[model samples]
Target: MSKADEKYLDIVENILNNGYYDNNRTGIETYKLPHQIMQFDLSKEFPILTTKFVAFKTAVKELLWIYKDQSNDVRKLQAQNVKIWDEWMLEDGTIGKAYGYQVAKFKQIDNLINTLKTDPQSRRMIISLWNIADLKDMSLTPCCYETLWDVENDRLNCMLVQRSGDIPLGVPFNMCQYAVLVHLIAKVTGFKPGLFTHVINNAHIYKNQIEGMKLQLKRRKQAYEAPTLWINPEIKNFYDFTPNDIKLIDYKHHEKIKMEVAV
Candidate 1:
């Protein structure tokens, strides 16, 4: 089994058997421990969940739209039939200061890329999108609020900090999304992608998702090996990458496990 499945199953089991009964925005529920972190060494393999079909291409497009284009337009995503952010778009079709605004304001994306190229040893490499001043203007705040980057032995590592996560809905997508981001950045920055550590401050499974969680837990032991991702060799520029340029090779897995999307 891949480390991702093991970690996910462990969380589900803990929630089902030992999680405390509690009430939150998702109503009365048993929640797994929050602030529970899982780390996967990307050097071994990519961290996508083989037990379920993650929208890997869609996730890549959205990530690229945010950091590469530095855009906040929902129509840009809608043009590609990706409506993940449609719910959060304002009437004017922008998402306020949440995503690309933060990228542009601090020049965070370019700075990180430049630092990775010139000073890979720098410990201060970070990109933050959760601007407090811009929160009130946003329909929804950023969940994966921050990323801290590190480098070792010419391999790039990333630590993603999410302030909140709806395990059945959002966590899986975010995990794969950022992991791919690490790989993309590594390639553009002239290093191999390494570890991806996800830290969730509020990693809770909703009450409606209990059965799905239980179902996923049953297939945990049957999960396949992590898949290897391939990016086009000739694409040197980060902005030049499109969905067609990113590919997942030898992605073996059992049947996909479907779950409810928490609102």
Candidate 2:
């Protein structure tokens, strides 16, 4: 089994058994555990869950929309038949000053890329989306808000810091999205993909989604091995990447476990 399955399922199982029940902003009660962590060696195997179906293309599109396009508009995603951001889109037809807005506001992606090329050993590499002044303007505050980058022995490593994680519905997507981000950045910056670590400050499963979690957990034993992430070698520039430029080869997985996103 892939380390993603082994570790993620372990997290789910542990939360179901020991998580603290609580109420929060979404009004839906949740069983939450604090400070959940998952680490992956990207050079060994891509870390995507195979216990259930994940919309890989959709995840990649969202990632690009945030980093490459640096856009807050949901319509662009809608044009691609991606509606993941619909819930948080404000009246102005955008997600407000969040995600890409933050990335673009400070030229985070360009700075990261430039720094990676010019100074690989710089420890000051960080991208933050949790802007205090703009929080109220945002439809939804950034959950996976910050990423701290590093380079070691020609390998690019990233640590994704998420303030909150909706375990069943959102965590799976975030995990795959960031891993792909690491690979994409590594490719563009002329480095190999290394360790990709995910840190969730609050990892929770909504009360309404417990059965879905239990259902996915049952498939744990039969989880398939991780698939290989293929990137278009010709595209050395990050902005040129689209969902088509990346793919999962031999991706085998069980059926989807539908769950509600606690808005």
Q: How many pairs collide in each candidate, listed in order?
A: 0, 0
Query: Model 2: clashing residue pairs?
Result: none
Query: Candidate 1: where are CA atoms >4 Å away?
Result: 26-30
TM-score of 2: 0.99
Q: Residue 145 in model 2: shift from native, Å?
A: 0.2
lDDT of each: 0.83, 0.95
Worst 10 residues of 2 by lDDT: 84-93
Angstrom error at residue 262, model 1: 3.0
Angstrom error at residue 161, model 1 = 0.5
TM for every model, in the order presented, reads 0.93, 0.99
Query: How many residue pairs of model 1 clash at the backbone?
Result: 0
